[model samples]
Target chain A: MDRQLDQLLSSAGRPALCQSVLPALLGCIADIARTLRTSHTVALAGTANAFGDDQLNVDVAAEKLVRDALAKCPAVVAASSEEDPAERPVRHSRDAGQTAEEASSEQYTVAFDPLDGSSIIAPNWTVGTIVGIWDGASALRQPPAERQVAAVLGVYGPRTTAIVALRVPGAEAACLEVGIGDQDFRFHVIRSRVRFADPPFATRYFAPANLRAAAESPSYMRLITQYVGKKYTLRYSGGLVPDVVHALAKGHGVYVSPVTAASRAKLRRLYELCPIALVVECAGGRAIDPVDGEEILARPLEGCDDRAGLVCGTTDEVDEVKRELLGASLESCR
Target chain B: MDRQLDQLLSSAGRPALCQSVLPALLGCIADIARTLRTSHTVALAGTANAFGDDQLNVDVAAEKLVRDALAKCPAVVAASSEEDPAERPVRHSRDAGQTAEEASSEQYTVAFDPLDGSSIIAPNWTVGTIVGIWDGASALRQPPAERQVAAVLGVYGPRTTAIVALRVPGAEAACLEVGIGDQDFRFHVIRSRVRFADPPFATRYFAPANLRAAAESPSYMRLITQYVGKKYTLRYSGGLVPDVVHALAKGHGVYVSPVTAASRAKLRRLYELCPIALVVECAGGRAIDPVDGEEILARPLEGCDDRAGLVCGTTDEVDEVKRELLGASLESCR
Candidate 1:
């Protein structure tokens, strides 16, 4: 059941590493989710993810299934999981026959939130997995979110799906790459919208916020009231992945997490925000910090625990969040 | 296939008409939902329901399927649908061999809201079908909501489900059925929670409200703010069927529709509120009118076009809505 992560990746001199890992990652996630769906028991596992959030037994199993599968892959150099409690990242061994040259060139850093929102699985609400792939072991030297070269969201509900995005633009395009350094990563989505119908949704726009937390603050409360006043609908499922991907499939709406006095950021920057922001931004949508308007994917990964409120989705809604939550003027918000 | 509705009845005037229609109606709804789910086109049908609401093609097809099926049923002497724009209710013919004496005793009335909230199919959010069955073709004689004898909710999402309920108790009990008349209709749920996880969702309460509409008034704004302040989650899919069903499945949480000045009520009392309220109440949950503290199913279906603000879900959350929105005392609201 375990596949070496590195063997699935291509060397730097060869094709893109994302090409090999994409399908493998998607397969691993789907295989695990499908198996869990058939099991009648979906209760809490008395376990939690790295951030101490309670994990469902199904989620704990899905996390292990993915961690073990990726950890066995030779291409996966350093791996971090939302469910893994270990302080040091898990580093997989190179394949038996791999030469040092091949090992160094093909190695990848893989970070993932194995079962995002597994709690919803009980009532069979839509749930998903989110993964971020970075080039080489450097994913460890600096913050992992900043180093992510690819991110994918896999949703399993009424229909199964793998929404994939890759940074494939070559060195020639230096514009968006400056944020990611010399990697010259450009936004490119490989797949999207599994079983969801194509867009033409009259007024479906997602605004993911903590209602209780929002009400405590006047500014955040204003943003929420304004969204409702505009007659905008929401898709806040208490899970980050499903909310973001729902909007992604519809090609509209915004998913936001605003900072409140009690909680600086509820979503993990690397496991939650980075992958979603990358997918959204690549889909002709916008992903930015609610505070400074910096690209969400480019937010400096200050540390493993670094967190910043994020707003992601279509330009219109994100623009609204920027103006309302951050007080960015309409002129400068977009 | 259209089955004559009358032949299914006992004709002996056994208990009531609901007993005969419950099984047939559930079968009809389940059949139509399952068929629509497999169709390739999940897009909008470019048509709308009677309320001037947009209809998904799946919904349009589902509506036709239910109307046609019920029309052939002999037990269903009179039938009306949310999608049918006709002036007269469709009437099913009596069995070919039936005499006038038997026909008079066997006939029943059935009203349905087929394909409730089909628009969310674009994003594949949970959607459902609701049906309310009443005795006598005279269902047209009174507001169909007040005439309901039995009801069902069919949810089509990660799974297909059939939830049925009947008023088995005699009318002598004034505690729960004053709204349905001396018919002594009792509360009961046939089936429920096709895929939703069991209760104890920590804080997974779904408070479905019309945010924009709520904000138009001060009282509604206060209620919504209080919900947020109390840290309530939401599942407002702009569809009464799915939101109410979601809460029903979770076995906890609350779903509400408070009165607004501009709009009397958003959900149809006859087709939507009555059916869902029946299911939730039968499941050990509660459904009530935020204004008068009357049971939702007990609301006199004022007329065909009657709509009302509703609140339903687990006891605690609903009690909160009654107290905050309707100013009901702790003991009086319950």
Candidate 2:
């Protein structure tokens, strides 16, 4: 299984940076998946994150696992997590005395949402881990399109699977779907080149996140009505990772999390949005800012807590969302 | 793990019938879960079922596994499945020559949707197996409230879990949530008495299936608007088993599959609706026919192909759905 992942990365022209970082990110994901399956009872941690969201025991544990794994990777100089928003220096055990400046030249940074859907985990629903690997000492103040080298969306569902997107400096960008074996916890390539379904599908699917935003945004509400009228299947799981991964797995679908005045978007750009956008774009889909209707990858990460509304999935469906949600206002401006 | 399940059933006064049937039913479910986790590739069978829904290779395999397992349970005299919607006599190995009439005295019948969410399975999303155990040679022409002795909803998700509801003739009805261990494939009781969350929850959830029906029924449309307007969390997964299971796991949610002129209900009464209704009701929730707003358990199964709209979940939420969807018309009639 590991061989398949190695082959996929090699075919995509693996940079030395990804070679050091991917294993650490994926290893933590595997550990988390195993822990989730075995630990039947997940308790509330009696604490909240910086964002004031309550943390589960599993969430805290997963965040630690990710941090610990990244600390072992010599090339991963800095990392930020959703649970802990501050970007911290990751000092490898082998190079304990290495200064931040000395490591800056060949260093990579990571931003991860260790456990993305903790709200739904108590119910034993499928959650996920999102990791974005940036080719720098830190991910701050840089657009994902320019700095993000690879991203992994690890899905903990009926089967542990991942959508890995690699965009090294020189090679062709690739998105690969791999399944983790229960016994070995190793990833085996499921689909080497994951892409959205060719257009004109018989039944289209949509995952409309933050449906509460509909009450405030008439356009968002109308878009949902249009989708229902068109007989598009609804597939929201209340988890950003699974919802977006659905589009990648099925090869079709749209996932929209709109930010309205009444319902502010909560998905962080550094930990969640950028990683997801990288994977979606790599899969031949589109990921865009819901407000401006621009590619999400083009947005720069201002800080660890940067949040945004996302409209992502099949290219045409995303285009349709932008047109329906922003068309009237844009036309009025014109 | 098995001990926990045995204890749960024993506490509910396990009828000699469930002793033979439960093991067989759950064994098949565990087998299916294992198969689902391991099978990396699932292909289309290139054929459709009696309902004209395309079947996947995994779906076909699951149906056969269920039938084969039931064939070993001497007490399970007959069985029917969604794939093959005809009642067939299940002949045990030791009782190969036993006539259906001879076996009928102590026999139980089984109706199952071996794989409830084949459409979403291709996306590597969580799907499930639903089994309803009836205390008779056949399940036709009897209400689930009287005939359904036990029901099991096997969830194949990030963690393999099952909600087992037992309603034998004499003992108190009980609902249990159990997790299936990956290694041993044994059932471990997670929640012994799975009940809906106590009322007055801060955040309510709703899974509105067949959203297309919203276009045909103004009442259904208004109900959805009310849910969104009231800020109910959307948790639909386009899969019946997981959607309903979410309600059980979260302890507060409603799943509505409304039947209208445009969107006819597809959930089979014998296989899908009855089992789910049993589990929900056992969990102190309510399961009702969406049109009449009556308890779903009271409806008699006319045939294996009988299908109906279901509004089930937290008791109060189910009541709210009925009130919103049927209140105006009822008031007009009054």
Candidate 3:
């Protein structure tokens, strides 16, 4: 390796924060993805099944990866999951001047879906990762609605994009884009103005099933049909990577689900499967409970239990769907 | 890029087979897996109720990756799970020696579980690829089982391991082996000498529900206590990658579901997950069909839909389980 390149690689390999799970997961997954692309075998170690269930799912891998990344970091506390039966134990490496509480307290704890859209794997469908957060372990332990930390979802396809929510301080959100096919690539957050500058849906929709529902309403269906009839395409893949990429490229589509009864029905309420709902909302799009049209509560234990309803998209478009569904039938409300 | 490195990369990019739907699936899956590992956004195009009632699993971005890899191959027919209700078209690529007879005649085809264990993506479990052969398009045109020609399951884990089988001119039946994992991975054929290599007890017994019942059998219980006792360790991870890997490493285990009453009562019939069973048999283990104790057939389907029985390390172990189950119940066999 060139001296400069070696230095650069070493720097890249360095842990970014004391609570370094994110960087570690990012590095590990990147290596695995590249190896697989180059037609080589890739492996990951760290977390095993804490729940002791025989079934394999993304939660296991995601938790494992996150925990491994954070293994060296002492600041992160309670990197937890809806799927995990227990809170991850902080087996952090010993460091000087670190109290047990300070070592375990997460300045930032990331909850994630390490690999999403996994059911399609046997047939070779695209999969993705979703990561978001709440205040800390206390907030995470709270029911889903009570926690209020920002989040992000890194959806992978031919390229990978990150929808990041800046939680503290300014508390703004942005979309970070990375092209995997491009050899020398870097991430650039989609500008804030570009994220929320337009009316969410002035035309047809291109969305993943879950997000489409969370972000729109039944009345929007009329608009969607009109838009499609005018040559707009309503495209969606079961894989989150493809779905989010299409939405990102097209501009107006909701990258996540819309909050409306009809829309939620459309999504089949796969809450954790598409954490992009939080990502989309944080990035200036709408995130809501489709049936009630309420803002989505961050870190809500109740809403993300593999059974809660969620929706995301531009605010106005989401409202339209909710209005239409509410007007149509009370049954739709449930 | 270095010329040598570029050449190696290009060669790595080459499609493996000449005439099959596999090239596309392989490339797409490999790319998506790479993208996921690398944390890049991936997108798919052209998906809508194509292969079955559900959307075809392939899309535009995935197709491009597949095409680029297959550009140099000698493929006759290129089938994809993504294309709209159509068999893969035959190519006139010069390398394939396209001729009147060749173009019109039925050609070989491949069926693939391009991405396996994907459901675990959300949970981060081991995922893999499953490829199989079909004499023609018959298996694909109608049902799953009809298309198996030769089959292999490629699992993405700590190491890439390919559990493969071929029904070639081997004097008699199919031969199975672990072709992709371990630095010293070698194909070892099952011979009578090693056939009973292990103890008389089933080496690995999973399917806890069924095993518990088998353990309750008075005769089987006596045998386990007297012979197979403490050494028996029940191991099963819903993820096939680990389960198969563990079984391969450990030698023998029973993974039967007890489908039929007689088979269930006797605890003998575990032939359903053929590839797994084949690997065991090829590795000098015994896979029983419980009901008839016939040579287990790998069902030509998507999942482990067959009734279960016993998988043992040695013939003696299988016989012990069989004798207890069939003691006087042979006439009751289904």
Chain A TM-scores for all candidates read 0.76, 0.92, 0.65
**Candidate 3 chain A least-lDDT 10 residues:** A40-49
lDDT of 3 by residue, A1-334 (tens): 1233223223322222312443344454554343332222111111111212411433465557655655655555656554453445457655423555445434545455555554333222234656555455533345443243444455443334444443333323334333222233333333222254364344444342442332234344443333333433344444554455344444455433434444234332223533455556544666666546666554344333434454455666566555654556656557
Q: What is the C-alpha lDDT of each candidate?
A: 0.58, 0.80, 0.40
Better of 1 and 2 by TM-score: 2
State in Å the error of residue A23, model 3. 2.5
User: Could you give the DockQ of candidate 1?
Assistant: 0.19
Model 2 CA deviation exceeding 4 Å by range: A1-4, A43-55, A94-106, A332-334, B1-4, B43-55, B94-106, B328-334
Q: Which has the greatest lDDT?
A: 2
Per-model RMSD to reference:
9.8, 4.1, 16.4
Higher-ranked by DockQ: 1 or 2: 2
Highest DockQ against the true fold, candidate: 2
Cα deviation at A313, candidate 2, in Å, is 1.4
Candidate 3 local distance difference test against the native: 0.40
What TM-scores do the predictions have? 0.72, 0.91, 0.44
How are the candidates ranked when ordered by DockQ, highest leading? Answer: 2, 1, 3
